[model samples]
Target: MLDYRLFKQIDDCFASGHADKARRLLMEVQSRSIALRDEMNMLHIRLKTLEDALQLARNLFNRDGFYWLKTGDVTQGPFCPRCYEDEGALIRLERTGSKLHCPYCHASFIGSARAAGGGAHHAHILPFV
Candidate 1:
């Protein structure tokens, strides 16, 4: 299958409108399915999903800072990046009143769009040089 560099090459090929080459590279990965572990096989499937999402450029970090996945005409979100990347898990964030919380790590925030620095409008301290 393709490694990170080859995947990047595929990205470059697609960027240059070389669909044939990109598809070919994707096929190489699919063709090597038998040699890949179950996790790898699953990852390839997920990668394909991500590839389409990226192509659409619809996957975005919502106002609350959680990654939202767009599906067709609908958008789903509040995904925790910490869980997704670290544990290979797609854990959704919980909206509790004014805060979006990640249950996995207990990390909570009001998000940049909503917070605007979360009440720190004036500086009481300066850099001591």
Candidate 2:
């Protein structure tokens, strides 16, 4: 967690054996190191909190992980975060390209290379028929 750039600078000074400047830089490095350590501890606490929330979400959704089955006329869920957005929309839709439209709401679901996840890439359309 040390600011690696500053750590490197201090290391270079130490390696050069410039005792006076090295001493000063060493103090700076040590101070930054302590500050970085405290920051890391804070992040650790945050990570623990998120893990707890994710676990609780799994339990509430009756699922074992980040994914969960969405219920309704759709009958499928446990979708990844991106897919969940479409699930939230009034109508589920996917656009294969600039030309395609939502089968349900007739909304344009333009395709984009930026939509990169395998399962979450294209909105899988389920037939209402």
Candidate 3:
């Protein structure tokens, strides 16, 4: 989910009557939100596969099994731990500085992955045969 601060900023910008600024920020937020949702869906599928594999391991070996990490129904990262990649979840403009942080993992990057390139930070694909 995109942070509430993003919506607030959009509101603030529009409230200030800067149409161009508000439009640009809103567009950026929308783009980031879409990318985050896609990544989250992929993570869900990947974690499900991992869970299935662990179940099989438990059945076959009849021993202690390694399990995937998850916080509630979601896996435990907004940034890919393997790559330290990040997606924007919240926008903050405090007195210190402006920065973006992921609400899930609390990882902060220089900028949104999409703005840096054209897609999310790293595309992780699991190989199946």
Highest-TM-score candidate = 3
Reference-based lDDT, residue 114, model 3: 33
Off by over 4 Å in 2: 1-17, 61-129
Q: lDDT (0-100) at residue 31 of candidate 2?
A: 87
| Per-residue lDDT of candidate 2, residues 56-75 (tens digit) | 45543312222343344333
lDDT of 1 by residue, 1-28 (tens): 4366778988999999999999998888
- Please report, in order, the local distance difference test score of every candidate based on alpha carbons: 0.62, 0.49, 0.47
Clashing residue pair totals per candidate (backbone < 3 A): 0, 4, 0
- The TM-scores of all predictions, comma-separated, are 0.38, 0.38, 0.42
Q: Candidate 3 — worst ten consecutive residues by lDDT sum?
A: 60-69
| Distance from true location, Cα of 27 in model 3, Å | 0.7
Q: What TM-score number comes out for model 3?
A: 0.42
Per-residue CA lDDT of model 3 for 1-129, tens digit only, reads 676687788889888898888898888899988999999999999999999868544432100111123434543222323222233122221111333343344333332233212343332222323
Q: In model 3, what is the error at residue 72, expressed in angstroms?
A: 27
Cα RMSD to native, each candidate? 16.4, 13.4, 24.2
Regions of candidate 3 where Cα sits further than 4 Å from its true position: 1-4, 61-129
